[model samples]
Structures are given as structure tokens and as C-alpha cells.
Target: MSNITTAPFTYESLSQLTMKEGVLELQVGPAHAGSGHMRILVWVEGDTVVKVDPDIGFVHRGVEKLSEDRLYVKAIPIVERPNLVDTVNANLGYIIALEKLLGLEAPPRAQYIRVITAEISRIISHLYGIAIYGIFMGSSTVFMWALADREPFIDIMEELTGARLTYSHIIPGGVRWDLPKDFGERLEVALKYLEGRVSDYEKIWMNNPVVRARAEGVGILSGAKATELGVVGPNLRASGVKCDVRKCAPYSVYSDFDFDVPTFKEGDSYARLLIRVEEIKQSISILRQALKNIPEGKIIYEDYYKRMTPLMKSIYDEKGRVKFTSLLTSLSPPKGQSFSRVEGGRGEIFFYLISDGTKNPYRFRVVTPSFRNLPYFTHVMPGHKLADVPVIYGSIDYFPPEADRR
Candidate 1:
């Protein structure tokens, strides 16, 4: 037998190969079809995606670093910028951390309000994810319906918080506003509409044969692997992992509300899609419960309330609103480090704060679910077809801005 030496694998050797029979590279861009600015380098071999390398970090704003420069309360809106769709939960986690540092707990009504807004934010985020997922899977109807349904929720949010997307409503002491007088009525109507629309979604998208063929068994991430990779949110739950920050560690008023933490055993793209639907239903249930059970009390804690000026207190009493004071611009919590976690629409989000008894936090760190779940991309993309890239992407719901924050 003749001695034959194998050629070394290198960039030059790969470049020399023909594009037709050999692997071809396709760049999905800075203006990628989905939400954030992210590039995906796909290496294809005969319509099969043999390897996928997710190129991110184009939207990094150094949110964590910036938080150190701003006062504790001012950082809320700064952190909110990274994940505009999931605003309430993102703000909630950081506020909870600040509250821990100051040894403050929001009142019962404030807790309920936080729960309602956070859950609403969760629904909004999930709808956005599902809409993108539907479009990626080649179903325009699904996208249209999801977006159309999403508008009512956004309207409700605007009425409640005065801003549609980036509402820094949750503060260290309590929420910024109380439930609007007609908020429950409007919410009930929207919930009714959503209840009907979810069934329509099941018929038009989830149960559709074409969608099933494309999404089912595609991009499977097993529980063991998901755990090993430290994935969170619906992605981890879809992988048969029963982990949700809401259920595992009850924060805000989530422990009081009765709602199921939806999970799936399939751990595939279809499962991820279905889990969002279930989560929406559960969120609606929580919303209804929160509306019914919300107590009539001060939105802010007495400690914060007492310190407000007469005019500010009057505004809060009359309109259920408050303004940021000069004191808030220079908060000095006792020297200590505290961390808080919340179950966002995507998954578990964490905020760690270090206070040296100063106006600004000495150190601030965030662990968003998208950042934690990113590894799922490279882990599951290898054995899938090139056509399945968008499906896998939409299912994971990776938000690059949130993930890339320093």
C-alpha cells in the first residue's frame, strides 16, 4: 500500500476548494431580517448548514459600564434601553437589587402593579418573538395576526405608563403609577380578544402542516445540553428543564399569583414556539388575577412617600404619579452588594449591584437571558439545513443588544 498523507485543514486550503461542491459561506447581515443588528456566517454543504457561527456585538452599548457613571435611580432607564421589548422585567430586576441595597420592599399594591406590568411586558416580548418566528417560517398571516394582537397590549401599556416601550415605571421604592381607573376594563377587553386570537393562531400557524414540517424536531437542544450550556428562558424550559426564576425564586408578587410555568419536553423550534403561546395564556391569567386581587393602597412605600415634597405628594395622591427628585439623582445606599433576578419573557435575568454608600454604584452587572442563551445557537445550528437558520434564530429569540451589553 502506498503511504498517503492527509492534507492539513487551514483557511488557505478551505479557500482553494470550489464553492459548488465544497462548503460555501453566506453572511446574513448587519441588517439581518430580524430584530437586532447581528451577522450570522453560515457554512453550507449541499443545502445543509454544516456549521453556523453567530457574529454578534454590533449593538453593544456598554450598559453595565454606563450604570456605574449614573446615579442608582437614573440607571433604570439606561438599563431599559438594551431590551426595549422586555422593559418592565429588565427594570424590575435592577430596581429589586437597588431596593435590597436600601432594605426597601414595595407595598402590596406596588408589588401587584409590578407583577401586572412585568407580565404584560412578557406578553409583549413573546408576541414580538412569535411574530418574527412566524415570518421566518414563511407565514405572513401569523406575523400579521401576532402584530395586530400586540397593538392592544401596547396601547394598554401606554395608558398605564405614559410610554409604550421604555417605561421605567418600577423604582426601588415602588411603581411610578397606580393602575388607571379604566385600566381593568380595557385589559379585560384586550384579554378577551387575545383569548380568541390564540385559538386562531393554533389553527392558522401552530397546527399548520407546513409549519409543523419546518419547525418540529428542528434545532433540538436537550435538557442535559441546555443545562451544560447554561441556557435560560423558554429555551431551557422547552428542553425539559423546569427552571423559571418566577417559580424557583418568587419575587415581586409572582408568588401570590396562580399561574403555571409552561415547559416542553421536545426542546425543538416548534416546542419553543408553542411555549410562548402557553406563556401568553398564563400571563393573561396572571393579569386577570392581579387586577382582581390588587389592593387599594399607596403605590410607593411610606419611607419614600414621606420624603416627597408636598406638591409631589399631592400629584401622587391625585394622579397616582410621582417625579424624580434631586434626592433620587443622588442616592446613597448603605455600603453593600446585592443581586436580584426576575423571570423575563425570554428567561431569567439577573442584576448585581455593588454600593459603596455613594450616589453611583461602585459596580453594576447584568446577566440577561439572551446572553445566557446565546450558546444554544452554535450548539444546535450544526445539523440543520440552511433554510432552518431563521427558524432556529427566531425560536431562540436572541436579542443582540441585550446580549452584547457590557
Candidate 2:
């Protein structure tokens, strides 16, 4: 065999090359929505993308480092701050790791409540992502309807957690509060409204000729490729992968509920979009089951309960909620390392924590779905038309803050 050599394609060489032969370079974004202020460099040969480089980290805030500085309980707020729409899901991973280190599990009633809140957050996050997807695809009506539908869920969250977003509701021992007396009825009404609206969404967005032509078969990711790339959540399921943290690992009370993991063989932007819609329906089903079979019992672990003052205990008894004091800041679990995984709106989220029997953790690490899904863009974007970039990116619902937190 003859020896062969290839030179690296550096920016300096590209700049030095002639601007002929239909080779063009362009920049897309600083995207305005979904992930804010993120850019992608596109190299085009005629109208087709020859290569694309994603530019991220516009909103990095060192979330993992911040976690190491804060106390164990106080870090809940810091953990979910990156992904506000999926607060309960984002917090669940960290809380699970914490509980593992502490060797405690939330009560059965608490587990059910956690499921209820987490599924609601999943619905909210999917709505927000789908709305953004609609806007990116130039369907303002879809954006308007999906966002308007989201308010009811947010209203319910406010009632449950006393916050519209960044709830910090999921704690190590259990959730923060018991369900309200009227929550079941309100949720049923909301789910019904959403179920009806989903059909409208199908008619106006999914089945629309323009949307179907633009999204269907565009940015196809084969099942083998999706698995090889380690894509997660709806993006992975859209490619016909039968994997879900809830179904496979069954953390929390996910095993108690029965809901299908939606999959599509098309593995395109359209399939990704529809998977999320089906997941929303599944989440509604889960919520109905959880609400119907929810048990009545303690919301927090007995160990934590015994440490509460009489006045605080009285408040908990009256309000069905616990008020944590700064005294928890001194908590130091036994020396150990633990990891947790949860299904977020976009995909799977993972947390790895190391404790050294100190006021602060020795290490805190996170792998968000958005972060894991990012590689798929580099792998799939080439050979598609330049216009297809945003469609594929939006379909993935890449949240930069969550991705860049590390």
C-alpha cells in the first residue's frame, strides 16, 4: 500500500482557500428561543450543509461547582435552577442520589405524590418544548395554543409547591407537601382539556401538509445510530429505541404506574415531535392512575419528622407540609458515592454524587438530556439543507442552560 497523508481542515486553511466552487460559510443563531444565545457554524456546498459545528456554553453558570459549595438540602434550589420547566424531574435525580447515600427512601404516599408532581412537570416541559418547536417551524398558532394550555398546569404547580417554577419541591426524604383536597378534580379537568387540545394540535400542526412535508423524513436518525450516539428521551424513542428510565430502571414509584413509552420508526424531526405528544398523553394516564390509587400517610421520613420542633410539627400536621430550617445545613451523610437517573422532558437526566461526611459534598456531577443529545446534531445535520438545521435542533429541544451546567 502507498503512504497517504491528509491535512487538518483548520479555520486558517479555509480562510486561505478561494471562495469559488460554491463553498459558503454561514452562522445560525444565537437562537432566540429554547436555548438562548447559542450559535451554530454551517458550511454549505450549494444549499446542502456540508458540515455543521454547534457552538454552545452561552449561559454557563457553574451549577455543579455551586452545588459543592452549598449544603445538601439547600442544593435542591441550585440543582433545579438550570431547568425550571422540569424542576421536579431535575431535582429528583439529585434527591435520589442523596437518599441512596443516606440509606432512606420516601414513604409510599410520598412516592406516589412524587410521581404525580414529576409527571405534571413532564407535561409542562413537553408543552413548553413543543410550543418552541412550533415557533421555530414558523407556526405561530401552535405556539399560541401550546403556551396557553401550559398555564393551567403552572397554576396547579403553584398551588402544590408555592412556586410557579424552580419549585425545589422534591427533597431527599420525600416531596415537600401532601396533595390538596381539590387537586384531583382540578387535574382531571386540566387533563381532559389537554386531551381535547392535543387532537387540535394534531390537526393544526402535525397533519398540516406544510409541517408534515417539512418535518417528516427530515433529519433521519436510524435506530442503530441513535443507540450508538447515546441519544436519550423522546429523541431516542423517536428512533424506535425501547429504553426509558421510568420503564427500564423504575425509580421512585414509576413501577407502580402503567404507561407506555412512545416510539416511532421514522426517526425524523416529525417522529421526535410526535413522541413528545404521545408522552404527554401517557403522563396524563399516569396522573389519573396515581390520583386514583394514592395512599394517605406521612409525607416525610420518620427520622426527619422526629427532628422537627413541636411547633414545626404542629404546622406540618395542620398544613400537610414540612418547613425545613437551616439546621439541615449541617447534615453530613456517610462517606459514599451514589448515582441516579430520571426521565426529563427532553430525555434522561443523571446525577452522580460523592459525600465525604462533611457539610458539603466532595463532588457533584450531572449529565442532562440536552447535553447527551447534543452530539446527535453533529452526527445528523450534515447532508441536509441549511433550512433543516433549526427544525432538527428545535425538535430535539436542546436547553443550553441544562447542557452547560457542568
- Count of backbone clashes, every candidate in sequence: 1, 0
Model 2 poorest 10 in a row by lDDT: 1-10
Q: Name the top TM-score candidate.
A: 2
- In candidate 2, stretches whose alpha carbon ends up further than 4 angstroms from where it belongs are 1-21, 31-35
Judged by whole-model lDDT over C-alpha atoms, candidate 2 comes out at: 0.86
Model 2 residue-pair collision total: 0
Model 2 residue 322 lDDT score: 82
Give per-residue CA lDDT, model 2, range 336-405, as digits (tens).
Answer: 9999999988889999999999979899999999989986667787778877887988899888788887
Q: Candidate 1 regions off by >4 Å?
A: 1-21, 34-36
Model 2 RMSD in angstroms:
4.4
Q: 1-406, model 1: which lDDT tens digit per residue?
A: 0121212223443344444567888888877664358888777888877666678889888898899999888899999998888999999999999989999888999999999999889999999989889887777888888888989999999998889799999887888888889999999999999999999889988899888888888888889988998999999999999998888899888888788988899888999999999999999999999999999898888888899999998998899996776666777999999999999989989999999998999999998988898776667876677787888888998888888877
